[model samples]
Target: MTHISKYRMKSRVEKRIKDNFLRSILSGGSARRQAILGELLTQTEKIMLAKRLAMIVMLENDFSYYRISKTLKVSTSTLKRLHRHILAGSYRQILTSLTGNRADAIIRFLEKILEFRMPPIAGPGRWKFLDERRK
Candidate 1:
């Protein structure tokens, strides 16, 4: 069996993600995007993406990494990497641009419902735990 390098695989995936046809379909509207996503992704994949988005919103709202990890059942290392991505700015920009003020309102509502407490260090690059599980 041949193995693909991570960088090469990521490039390929990113290329597909940026494809014009895919972009057109995704930009078509919520119903179009939903239909395509439903067709392309499994239920578990959709759920995982939704969870990740929720985590992103919570992180932006100042929810603690540990608290989010506990509530969402995601690893701290995953949260840390996501935090780095947010701080890197692209995801933050996309989220804000896509959701507008509604994102903030929804996050606030979720925070109240989830009852998340702020941790002492919500800053990026603080988590030291490594994800050691093999895929």
Candidate 2:
């Protein structure tokens, strides 16, 4: 059997994201661009993903919103809408593999989520630990 690389897959996904974002800008914010990226972030409508990619692009880039808006020809609102989802941990299931190793896959998924989470919660908060009991 042939092996697939997680790094390669990650690059592909990141490329798609960059292409979609840049295309969204160059094409005057075409509906097609929006649709393509919108679908990848949803997961049975139960999870969120892609916050890191978006943050890296927007924050690291010096381009202003108006410049992006003008370049993509999209309203600031549309870009903001997608940005919100990415930042809010709304997109999901950003990983997949051809192997049968469930444990490795889950660890990768959780890592991706944690990387996006700020000051990522290390301990339970407002939620009871499995060992904790109430009076």
TM values, all candidates: 0.62, 0.25
- Runs in model 1 deviating more than 4 A are 1-21, 98-100, 112-135
Residue pair clashes in candidate 1:
none
**Model 1 worst lDDT window (10 residues):** 126-135
Question: Relative to the true structure, how large is the alpha-carbon lDDT of every model?
Answer: 0.73, 0.48
Q: Which stretches of candidate 2 lie over 4 Å from their true place?
A: 1-62, 91-135
Give per-residue CA lDDT, model 1, range 1-135, as digits (tens): 123456555777778866965776758789988788788777778778877888888887788988788778899998999889888885856576647677777676666656634444766633432222112
Candidate 2 lDDT by residue in tens digits, 27-117: 7456865575566445423222333333324422444666545543456776677666756765434322222455345445544543442
- Which structure among the candidates has the greatest TM-score? 1
Flag clash pairs in model 2.
25-72, 28-72, 29-72, 48-90, 48-91, 48-92, 49-91, 49-92
Candidate 2: lDDT over CA atoms? 0.48
TM-score (C-alpha, index-matched) for candidate 1:
0.62
